[model samples]
Target: MTKYQLFKKLPLFAYVNKIHVRYNPGGPNTETCRKLMLMLLDPKTFTKHPYLTFTYELLSFNERPEVFLTLVPQVPFRFHADTCTLDDIHRAIDADQYKAHCDYLKRRSIESKYVQEE
Candidate 1:
């Protein structure tokens, strides 16, 4: 694939929370994927001054052990080089993609709480 092709654009995103659908932007005409666009928006909720926000582009997949593992070693985790997935987020449902998703949510939650405490 051309270098440009690698960064062209994505086609779909699905966000699942605890085995439940949290958000999905349905694609059309037999398309199951849509380009994922992510941005941070501070929401003005009644209880607090404002809340930091984030989102994920999720997808469906059969159960895979790699799922949670991908998000773990962000700090305290490591894998044998012989078994590494070469940092490819799509190789398994268990790589940077998951980490990115979880990190975004975590930061949002922490920021929201901090703002509330202010």
Candidate 2:
């Protein structure tokens, strides 16, 4: 199942099975964008497969981190900071809500392409 689908099923667990974090110094005053990616697995079936994958761009434009899903390569899927927060993740899964966000981005992406060609 895709990361989105899996996230909808599995209860949120902050314990990451695997993670990678990288920090790049922009300058003395410039805020560095820290990139992070982590994999969450179901405790009961930890050995089976990874459940959720979270990719975040922290300090984006010197602001809050932007969450993303890499369930599908080459597709940029964005999540609202408020909607996909750590608290929400721990509360309940809302695949349909986030799915709508993904759809909106997809449409915007496609529309931009057409506008560029016109």
Candidate 3:
């Protein structure tokens, strides 16, 4: 696949399992956005293989922390402090660890197919 094509390619998991995460540091939607986004993107579903997106609703800006989890499941995903509590974020990461473990098993099983030679 071409680079652009690859970019366009949507992982099956993305469609099968998906969540919308929205967060705003401050303003009218701040409170609701933070809670809702955290719930939706909770890492508990890591094994489920979902494409999660974290969106910033406000234009007023500061450099957001590197959300490694949102981009790379191998690393723990960080929830923005301004928008979420530390405990909440940690719990999600804890849950993700279990799910990631399970995912490893599932992948091994699928890859274990022994193709017989004719």
Candidate 4:
């Protein structure tokens, strides 16, 4: 299946809680994927805060087990590289926030639909 289709099947939380890579770092789609993750994962309530920055770190190959993306939240929270599906991540997140995110996506989707019909 196409990447977009796969992403649609996953929960909104998955976009933030996990890393979604389509190609290597310099590939055209790489930045798009990164931005998408940031948009969904943005910490601000109601809207995303543009002032927040997104960053990534790569450890030397000598480091232990495996390499994964680390999200440095202003506040502490649990994060991991486990291979859980979107539903799993959804269940793990705070209920109210999950609902808010879903609502945000729904509103955005409706807005896009209206734009397309215009």
Q: TM-score for every candidate vs. truth?
A: 0.21, 0.27, 0.27, 0.28
lDDT of 3 by residue, 1-118 (tens): 6545532323322322223333435544345446545555568645555455444444345444222234235453445544555345445555555565456566667454443435
Q: Residue 113, candidate 1: how far off, in angstroms?
A: 5.9
* RMSD in Å for all candidates: 18.2, 13.6, 11.3, 12.0
| Candidate 1 Cα outliers beyond 4 Å, as residue runs | 1-89, 92-94, 110-116
lDDT of 2 at 14: 25
Which pairs, if any, clash in model 2? none
Worst 10 residues of 4 by lDDT: 66-75
Is candidate 2 or 4 superior in lDDT? 4
Best by TM-score: 4
Q: Which ten residues in a row have the lowest lDDT in candidate 2?
A: 27-36
> How well does candidate 4 score on lDDT at residue 19?
38
Which candidate should be chosen as best, given lDDT against the real structure? Answer: 3
Candidate 4, residue 80: lDDT: 35
Summarize candidate 4's per-residue lDDT along 82-110 as a digit string, tens digits. 23433444455545444545655776795
Candidate 3: C-alpha RMSD to true structure equals: 11.3
In model 4, what are the clashing residue pairs, if there are any?
A: none
